[model samples]
Target: MAKQKIVRVDYRLIHGQVVAKWIKYHPVKRIIVADDELKNDEFMCDIYKLAAPGNEVDIISIAELEETLNKKDDDVMIIFKDIKNAKLALNSGVKLIELNVGAVQNGKDSYFVTSGVALSKEEFKDLQEMQEKGLDIYVQPIPENEKLSLESIKNKIK
Candidate 1:
């Protein structure tokens, strides 16, 4: 199996920070945005592709991601729009050792977890399950930021 260098859950999938910072830090040849909604929207997918100029960007649905990952031999960074989608990918047999939680927009039911990260109770439960599954999940918007663990966030919520 090809290595999945980074599996990140960022609300803004392929933004300036991702292109300028995360890409450089991870040094992956391919960037895969795994979102069901984006897959069906060609115009949006094209925009995301354009955002990452040098590297190859593939905007694929969660269903197609598993197949795409299987055929790739290069180091790939997979980005999900939310933790639920990341959990879905994991349930579908995607092997991810670590997950970076970034930029989850604030919602009515969501609580602020860390810088650029907010999660509802349900989402937090999904994250807890992922952690139990042996995935190292942390909240870090950028490489320079401190990595906040799920345990710390859980304690804060309590």
Candidate 2:
């Protein structure tokens, strides 16, 4: 099976950093935004498409991620809107060895782990679970920043 080149969670999916920086860094032909809501929103879908000028941007529901991966052999990056969807993709059998956490906004019971990342208790737990499952998960908002492991964040919060 052809695996995704990068599996990332970024609330602002297909933004400037993604189009300008990430695609250049990884050189993926296709970028799949796996979000349940965005898949049904045509306007947002078109907006995301336009954001990535040269590459193909596909807005698919998280459930469709595995099937999409199965069909594609191209270098691809899968971006999820939240950690839950990323976890769901893993649970649903999408193969991912590492997860990049980026720019998840403040939500219920959430606290800032970084200026960009805010995780609630449950979200933190889910990340811990993913890490325990042997996934090398880390938070890094951009290519220039250092990737912070679960342990690093945990120590910071303590």
Candidate 3:
């Protein structure tokens, strides 16, 4: 199986930060956006594909992640829209070693953990669960920014 280079939890699956920044800095042969809802939506998938013109982009359901990654022979950056989806991927045996928390939406009851990361009570708990399972979790909104540990911002949560 090819290496799953980077796994990230970003609310915006594929945007300027990803196409213009992350991809520019850490070039990957493939980008897999693992989202259940968007996977089946052909129209939205096309738009995301267009966003990254030259790269191989696949919007696949969480169920397909393991098999897809196993079959591919190139380095990939797997992205989940939120922590829940990332957890789902983990529960399904994706073997993710580390996770990068990016711009999650500051929804109701969510606390701003850092510049671009916000977590509600439940979301923080989910991250804690992942951390307990030996997953290294950190926050870095963009490539140029410094990575912040999950423990570093625990005080931000109410």
Candidate 4:
């Protein structure tokens, strides 16, 4: 198995949007879900499994992420349900991967992740850390909605 190159954070997990967009956009072969809730939730994992066709999608723990996939230089897209786990995953060997913020609706107003998806205080801090680490973080829609252009995102980053 090869290493994953892209890491996405979507509260919704695998669904129609992800299957149709990122699976093809990044040409991803493996989908790794780094949500502890989903990692322990078998039923949720099953639901995610059904969404993906031929691709291998594993909902694993933040701990298992590195050992399972030693590198991040291949065709893989990692999805985390929250920023904390996403940062922990980054603490592993992951680097310079494109962060697609899928959804974080439950976050507080102070937490900035685009104009839409909310973020918790901790989540915001984690994102700041990830930024400090030099990860490429961007808020892109699930393809059904209007695309979020680089110019627009640059404003949010400022």
Output the number of the TM-score-best candidate: 3
Task: Assess candidate 2 and give its lDDT.
Answer: 0.86
lDDT of each: 0.88, 0.86, 0.88, 0.70
Residues 1-158, candidate 4: write the lDDT tens digits: 55566677787878777888777767877888877677888887898898999888877888888755764445777888876778777887655356767687663354454545665655656666777787767666564555453345444432
The candidate, 1 or 3, that scores higher on TM-score is: 3
Error of 4 at 126 (Å): 2.2
User: Which order, best to worst by lDDT?
Assistant: 3, 1, 2, 4
Tell me, by lDDT, which candidate is best. Answer: 3
The pairs that clash in candidate 1 are none
lDDT of 4: 0.70
Q: What tens digits encode model 3's per-residue C-alpha lDDT throughout 76-158? A: 88999999999998988889958999889989899998788889989989999999988999999988889988788888998
- Per-residue CA lDDT of model 1 for 1-158, tens digit only, reads 45788889998999999989998889888999999988999889889999999899888888888788888798889999988899999999878869999888888888887878878898899999989998899999889998988887886553
Clashes of each: 0, 0, 0, 1
How far out, in Å, is residue 32 in model 4? Answer: 0.7
lDDT, residue 54, candidate 3: 82
Model 2 Cα lDDT, one tens digit per residue, 1-158? 44577888999999999988888888888999999999999998999999998898888998887788778678888899899998998888777868999888887678888878998888889999888888889999998899888888885443
Q: What does candidate 3 score on TM?
A: 0.96
Select the stronger candidate by TM-score from 2 and 4.
Answer: 2
Q: How many backbone clashes does candidate 1 have?
A: 0
